[model samples]
Target: MFMNLLRENKIVAGILTILRLYLGYAWFTAGLGKIQSGAFNASGFLGNAVANPVKGPDGSVVYAWYVKFLESFAIPNVDIFNFIVPWGETLVGLGLMLGCLTTAAAFFGLVMNFSFFLAGTVSHIPTDLFLGFIILAAGYNAGRIGLDRWVVPFIRKTVLKGKEPAKQHA
Candidate 1:
Protein backbone atom coordinates (compact mmCIF):
# COMPACT_ATOMS: atom_id res chain seq x y z
CA MET A 1 0.00 0.00 0.00
CA PHE A 2 2.70 2.44 0.94
CA MET A 3 4.83 1.26 -1.95
CA ASN A 4 1.97 1.85 -4.34
CA LEU A 5 1.55 5.36 -3.05
CA LEU A 6 5.25 6.01 -3.37
CA ARG A 7 5.23 4.65 -6.90
CA GLU A 8 2.12 6.50 -8.08
CA ASN A 9 1.03 9.31 -5.78
CA LYS A 10 1.90 12.92 -6.59
CA ILE A 11 2.53 13.90 -2.97
CA VAL A 12 5.06 11.11 -2.55
CA ALA A 13 6.55 11.99 -5.89
CA GLY A 14 7.07 15.56 -4.69
CA ILE A 15 8.86 14.29 -1.62
CA LEU A 16 11.00 12.04 -3.80
CA THR A 17 11.91 14.98 -6.00
CA ILE A 18 13.19 16.82 -2.98
CA LEU A 19 15.21 13.81 -1.92
CA ARG A 20 16.60 13.37 -5.41
CA LEU A 21 17.64 17.01 -5.61
CA TYR A 22 19.41 16.86 -2.27
CA LEU A 23 21.29 13.70 -3.22
CA GLY A 24 22.13 15.18 -6.58
CA TYR A 25 23.47 18.34 -5.00
CA ALA A 26 25.67 16.30 -2.71
CA TRP A 27 27.09 14.24 -5.57
CA PHE A 28 27.54 17.31 -7.75
CA THR A 29 29.41 19.21 -5.07
CA ALA A 30 31.68 16.28 -4.23
CA GLY A 31 32.53 15.65 -7.86
CA LEU A 32 32.87 19.36 -8.62
CA GLY A 33 35.27 19.78 -5.76
CA LYS A 34 37.42 16.95 -7.03
CA ILE A 35 37.40 18.32 -10.55
CA GLN A 36 38.12 21.83 -9.40
CA SER A 37 41.07 20.64 -7.33
CA GLY A 38 42.70 19.65 -10.65
CA ALA A 39 44.89 17.12 -8.83
CA PHE A 40 42.32 14.82 -7.31
CA ASN A 41 43.34 11.19 -7.49
CA ALA A 42 41.69 8.01 -6.26
CA SER A 43 44.99 6.24 -5.63
CA GLY A 44 45.29 7.54 -2.08
CA PHE A 45 41.70 6.72 -1.35
CA LEU A 46 41.95 3.28 -2.91
CA GLY A 47 45.19 2.61 -1.06
CA ASN A 48 43.55 3.53 2.20
CA ALA A 49 40.59 1.28 1.42
CA VAL A 50 42.89 -1.59 0.60
CA ALA A 51 44.96 -0.98 3.69
CA ASN A 52 41.97 -0.78 6.03
CA PRO A 53 38.96 -2.72 4.80
CA VAL A 54 35.86 -3.02 6.96
CA LYS A 55 36.42 -5.40 9.87
CA GLY A 56 33.97 -7.84 11.36
CA PRO A 57 33.19 -8.40 15.04
CA ASP A 58 35.83 -11.12 14.96
CA GLY A 59 38.38 -8.57 13.78
CA SER A 60 38.71 -10.22 10.37
CA VAL A 61 38.07 -8.45 7.09
CA VAL A 62 34.36 -8.32 6.42
CA TYR A 63 34.91 -7.94 2.70
CA ALA A 64 38.16 -9.72 2.02
CA TRP A 65 37.29 -10.52 -1.57
CA TYR A 66 36.39 -6.92 -2.31
CA VAL A 67 39.67 -5.84 -0.75
CA LYS A 68 41.51 -8.31 -2.91
CA PHE A 69 39.68 -7.09 -5.99
CA LEU A 70 40.59 -3.56 -5.15
CA GLU A 71 44.21 -4.49 -4.65
CA SER A 72 44.41 -6.51 -7.87
CA PHE A 73 42.20 -4.46 -10.18
CA ALA A 74 41.52 -1.05 -8.71
CA ILE A 75 44.85 -0.19 -7.15
CA PRO A 76 46.70 -1.13 -10.30
CA ASN A 77 44.17 0.79 -12.34
CA VAL A 78 44.18 3.87 -10.14
CA ASP A 79 44.42 5.94 -13.26
CA ILE A 80 40.98 4.71 -14.30
CA PHE A 81 39.56 5.50 -10.86
CA ASN A 82 41.09 8.95 -11.06
CA PHE A 83 39.08 9.52 -14.22
CA ILE A 84 35.92 7.56 -13.47
CA VAL A 85 35.09 8.57 -9.90
CA PRO A 86 34.75 12.32 -10.17
CA TRP A 87 33.16 12.22 -13.62
CA GLY A 88 30.88 9.36 -12.68
CA GLU A 89 29.70 11.22 -9.59
CA THR A 90 29.07 14.33 -11.62
CA LEU A 91 27.17 12.42 -14.27
CA VAL A 92 25.09 10.58 -11.68
CA GLY A 93 24.27 13.95 -10.10
CA LEU A 94 23.23 15.43 -13.41
CA GLY A 95 21.11 12.41 -14.28
CA LEU A 96 19.33 12.46 -10.91
CA MET A 97 18.94 16.22 -10.74
CA LEU A 98 17.54 16.35 -14.26
CA GLY A 99 15.52 13.15 -13.72
CA CYS A 100 16.85 11.85 -17.00
CA LEU A 101 17.38 8.30 -15.74
CA THR A 102 16.50 8.46 -12.10
CA THR A 103 16.49 4.75 -11.37
CA ALA A 104 19.81 4.09 -13.07
CA ALA A 105 21.39 7.10 -11.47
CA ALA A 106 20.13 6.08 -8.05
CA PHE A 107 21.30 2.54 -8.61
CA PHE A 108 24.82 3.69 -9.43
CA GLY A 109 24.77 6.08 -6.52
CA LEU A 110 23.84 3.19 -4.25
CA VAL A 111 26.65 1.12 -5.68
CA MET A 112 29.18 3.83 -4.92
CA ASN A 113 27.71 4.40 -1.49
CA PHE A 114 27.98 0.70 -0.69
CA SER A 115 31.53 0.60 -2.01
CA PHE A 116 32.48 3.43 0.31
CA PHE A 117 30.74 1.79 3.22
CA LEU A 118 32.46 -1.51 2.56
CA ALA A 119 35.80 0.29 2.45
CA GLY A 120 35.38 1.38 6.09
CA THR A 121 34.14 4.82 5.23
CA VAL A 122 31.00 5.37 7.23
CA SER A 123 30.35 9.06 6.89
CA HIS A 124 26.88 9.69 5.36
CA ILE A 125 26.88 6.50 3.34
CA PRO A 126 24.09 4.85 5.34
CA THR A 127 21.77 7.79 4.82
CA ASP A 128 22.74 8.10 1.18
CA LEU A 129 22.15 4.41 0.65
CA PHE A 130 18.74 4.58 2.30
CA LEU A 131 17.72 7.60 0.24
CA GLY A 132 19.05 6.00 -2.92
CA PHE A 133 16.91 2.95 -2.21
CA ILE A 134 13.89 5.17 -1.73
CA ILE A 135 14.51 6.90 -5.04
CA LEU A 136 14.89 3.53 -6.75
CA ALA A 137 11.77 2.14 -5.12
CA ALA A 138 9.80 5.16 -6.30
CA GLY A 139 10.92 4.13 -9.82
CA TYR A 140 9.15 5.79 -12.74
CA ASN A 141 7.32 8.22 -10.54
CA ALA A 142 10.67 9.50 -9.35
CA GLY A 143 11.40 10.77 -12.83
CA ARG A 144 7.89 11.83 -13.75
CA ILE A 145 8.65 15.48 -13.14
CA GLY A 146 11.70 15.50 -15.36
CA LEU A 147 12.99 14.41 -18.78
CA ASP A 148 12.10 10.77 -18.20
CA ARG A 149 8.52 11.97 -18.36
CA TRP A 150 8.98 12.28 -22.12
CA VAL A 151 12.07 10.20 -22.88
CA VAL A 152 10.80 7.00 -21.28
CA PRO A 153 7.50 7.11 -23.11
CA PHE A 154 9.22 7.82 -26.38
CA ILE A 155 11.54 4.84 -25.88
CA ARG A 156 8.65 2.56 -24.96
CA LYS A 157 6.74 3.58 -28.05
CA THR A 158 9.62 3.41 -30.48
CA VAL A 159 12.41 1.12 -29.30
CA LEU A 160 10.00 -1.35 -27.75
CA LYS A 161 7.50 -1.33 -30.55
CA GLY A 162 5.90 -4.54 -31.90
CA LYS A 163 6.08 -6.15 -28.46
CA GLU A 164 2.59 -5.16 -27.31
CA PRO A 165 -0.19 -7.73 -27.59
CA ALA A 166 -2.54 -7.48 -30.54
CA LYS A 167 -6.32 -7.47 -30.12
CA GLN A 168 -7.65 -11.00 -29.47
CA HIS A 169 -10.66 -12.58 -31.14
CA ALA A 170 -13.78 -13.17 -29.08
Candidate 2:
Protein backbone atom coordinates (compact mmCIF):
# COMPACT_ATOMS: atom_id res chain seq x y z
CA MET A 1 0.00 0.00 0.00
CA PHE A 2 0.94 3.62 -0.40
CA MET A 3 1.20 3.87 3.37
CA ASN A 4 4.08 1.41 3.30
CA LEU A 5 5.93 3.62 0.84
CA LEU A 6 5.20 6.68 2.92
CA ARG A 7 6.65 5.03 6.00
CA GLU A 8 9.65 3.81 4.05
CA ASN A 9 10.16 7.25 2.59
CA LYS A 10 9.97 8.91 6.01
CA ILE A 11 13.69 9.41 6.42
CA VAL A 12 14.13 11.71 3.42
CA ALA A 13 10.76 13.27 3.97
CA GLY A 14 11.52 13.85 7.63
CA ILE A 15 14.71 15.65 6.82
CA LEU A 16 13.00 17.86 4.28
CA THR A 17 10.17 18.49 6.67
CA ILE A 18 12.56 19.46 9.44
CA LEU A 19 14.52 21.72 7.12
CA ARG A 20 11.37 23.43 5.94
CA LEU A 21 10.15 23.89 9.48
CA TYR A 22 13.39 25.36 10.82
CA LEU A 23 13.90 27.66 7.85
CA GLY A 24 10.35 28.83 8.16
CA TYR A 25 10.82 29.48 11.84
CA ALA A 26 13.97 31.43 11.16
CA TRP A 27 12.28 33.56 8.51
CA PHE A 28 9.17 34.21 10.55
CA THR A 29 11.16 35.05 13.63
CA ALA A 30 13.29 37.55 11.72
CA GLY A 31 10.23 39.09 10.11
CA LEU A 32 8.37 39.30 13.37
CA GLY A 33 11.36 40.87 15.06
CA LYS A 34 11.58 43.47 12.35
CA ILE A 35 7.90 44.15 12.71
CA GLN A 36 8.16 44.54 16.49
CA SER A 37 10.96 47.06 16.29
CA GLY A 38 10.32 50.69 15.43
CA ALA A 39 13.24 50.69 13.02
CA PHE A 40 10.88 50.01 10.15
CA ASN A 41 10.38 53.58 8.96
CA ALA A 42 14.00 54.64 8.86
CA SER A 43 15.51 55.25 5.44
CA GLY A 44 17.23 51.88 5.45
CA PHE A 45 19.57 51.52 2.48
CA LEU A 46 19.91 55.26 2.00
CA GLY A 47 20.81 55.68 5.62
CA ASN A 48 23.35 52.91 5.24
CA ALA A 49 24.79 54.47 2.13
CA VAL A 50 25.04 57.86 3.79
CA ALA A 51 26.39 56.59 7.05
CA ASN A 52 28.81 54.02 5.67
CA PRO A 53 29.66 56.27 2.71
CA VAL A 54 30.97 54.17 -0.15
CA LYS A 55 32.85 56.90 -1.95
CA GLY A 56 34.12 56.11 -5.42
CA PRO A 57 37.78 56.52 -6.40
CA ASP A 58 39.22 59.14 -8.73
CA GLY A 59 37.15 59.18 -11.93
CA SER A 60 34.86 56.36 -10.97
CA VAL A 61 31.22 57.46 -10.70
CA VAL A 62 29.79 54.22 -9.36
CA TYR A 63 29.59 55.41 -5.79
CA ALA A 64 27.88 58.61 -6.83
CA TRP A 65 25.36 56.66 -8.86
CA TYR A 66 24.81 54.30 -5.99
CA VAL A 67 24.34 57.21 -3.64
CA LYS A 68 21.94 58.81 -6.03
CA PHE A 69 19.99 55.62 -6.46
CA LEU A 70 19.85 55.03 -2.74
CA GLU A 71 18.84 58.56 -1.97
CA SER A 72 16.21 58.76 -4.66
CA PHE A 73 14.84 55.22 -5.02
CA ALA A 74 15.75 53.48 -1.80
CA ILE A 75 14.96 56.32 0.59
CA PRO A 76 11.53 56.87 -0.87
CA ASN A 77 10.44 53.26 -0.62
CA VAL A 78 12.17 52.17 2.54
CA ASP A 79 8.87 51.95 4.33
CA ILE A 80 7.30 49.93 1.55
CA PHE A 81 10.16 47.47 1.45
CA ASN A 82 10.13 47.23 5.22
CA PHE A 83 6.52 46.21 5.11
CA ILE A 84 6.65 44.06 2.03
CA VAL A 85 9.93 42.26 2.62
CA PRO A 86 9.14 41.12 6.14
CA TRP A 87 5.64 39.98 5.22
CA GLY A 88 6.96 38.22 2.15
CA GLU A 89 9.47 36.44 4.30
CA THR A 90 6.79 35.53 6.76
CA LEU A 91 4.57 34.15 4.04
CA VAL A 92 7.40 32.17 2.52
CA GLY A 93 8.19 30.84 5.99
CA LEU A 94 4.58 29.87 6.59
CA GLY A 95 4.24 28.13 3.27
CA LEU A 96 7.46 26.27 3.77
CA MET A 97 6.54 25.32 7.30
CA LEU A 98 3.25 23.83 6.16
CA GLY A 99 4.89 22.36 3.09
CA CYS A 100 2.15 23.89 1.00
CA LEU A 101 3.33 24.47 -2.52
CA THR A 102 6.83 24.11 -1.14
CA THR A 103 8.43 24.29 -4.56
CA ALA A 104 6.60 27.52 -5.24
CA ALA A 105 7.67 28.90 -1.89
CA ALA A 106 11.21 27.70 -2.49
CA PHE A 107 11.14 29.29 -5.95
CA PHE A 108 10.08 32.63 -4.58
CA GLY A 109 12.46 32.24 -1.69
CA LEU A 110 15.24 31.54 -4.16
CA VAL A 111 14.37 34.73 -5.98
CA MET A 112 14.52 36.68 -2.74
CA ASN A 113 17.90 35.18 -2.00
CA PHE A 114 19.21 36.09 -5.44
CA SER A 115 17.99 39.62 -5.11
CA PHE A 116 19.67 40.04 -1.76
CA PHE A 117 22.86 38.44 -3.01
CA LEU A 118 22.88 40.78 -5.99
CA ALA A 119 22.53 43.70 -3.61
CA GLY A 120 25.96 42.74 -2.34
CA THR A 121 27.53 42.15 1.12
CA VAL A 122 26.75 39.28 3.48
CA SER A 123 24.48 37.67 0.90
CA HIS A 124 26.29 34.42 0.48
CA ILE A 125 24.38 32.74 3.27
CA PRO A 126 21.01 33.37 1.72
CA THR A 127 22.27 32.35 -1.70
CA ASP A 128 23.63 29.04 -0.49
CA LEU A 129 20.68 28.34 1.77
CA PHE A 130 18.23 29.01 -1.04
CA LEU A 131 20.01 26.66 -3.40
CA GLY A 132 20.15 23.94 -0.78
CA PHE A 133 16.45 24.22 -0.07
CA ILE A 134 15.66 24.09 -3.77
CA ILE A 135 17.74 20.95 -4.15
CA LEU A 136 15.96 19.21 -1.31
CA ALA A 137 12.51 20.15 -2.55
CA ALA A 138 13.26 19.06 -6.06
CA GLY A 139 11.56 15.83 -7.09
CA TYR A 140 10.39 13.14 -4.65
CA ASN A 141 7.73 13.61 -2.03
CA ALA A 142 9.59 14.82 0.97
CA GLY A 143 6.34 16.49 1.81
CA ARG A 144 4.42 13.27 2.39
CA ILE A 145 3.00 14.22 5.78
CA GLY A 146 2.97 17.91 4.98
CA LEU A 147 0.41 19.98 3.12
CA ASP A 148 2.45 19.91 -0.08
CA ARG A 149 1.44 16.34 -0.75
CA TRP A 150 -2.13 17.53 -1.21
CA VAL A 151 -1.48 21.02 -2.52
CA VAL A 152 0.90 19.88 -5.22
CA PRO A 153 -1.58 17.42 -6.63
CA PHE A 154 -4.36 19.97 -6.50
CA ILE A 155 -2.12 22.47 -8.19
CA ARG A 156 -1.40 19.89 -10.82
CA LYS A 157 -5.10 19.42 -11.37
CA THR A 158 -6.04 23.10 -11.47
CA VAL A 159 -3.01 24.69 -13.03
CA LEU A 160 -0.47 22.36 -14.53
CA LYS A 161 -3.25 20.06 -15.71
CA GLY A 162 -2.17 17.06 -13.65
CA LYS A 163 1.42 17.60 -14.49
CA GLU A 164 3.64 18.33 -11.50
CA PRO A 165 6.26 20.97 -11.68
CA ALA A 166 9.53 19.52 -12.80
CA LYS A 167 11.91 18.71 -9.99
CA GLN A 168 14.97 20.94 -9.86
CA HIS A 169 17.80 18.39 -10.10
CA ALA A 170 19.65 15.60 -8.37
For each candidate, give its TM-score against the true structure.
0.92, 0.66
Residue range 34-128, candidate 2, lDDT tens digits: 77784655465547655565434563444555566667876777877777777777787777778777766676666666545434435445644
Q: What residue pairs are clashing in model 2? A: none
| TM-score, model 2 to reference | 0.66
RMSD of each: 4.0, 6.1
Model 1: runs farther than 4 Å from truth? 162-170
lDDT, candidate 1, 55-111, per-residue tens: 889998989999998999999998888888888899889988999889999999998
Worst 10 residues of 2 by lDDT: 115-124
The TM-score leader among the candidates is: 1
Report the CA-based lDDT of candidate 1 relative to the real structure: 0.88
**Lowest-sum lDDT 10-residue window in model 1:** 161-170
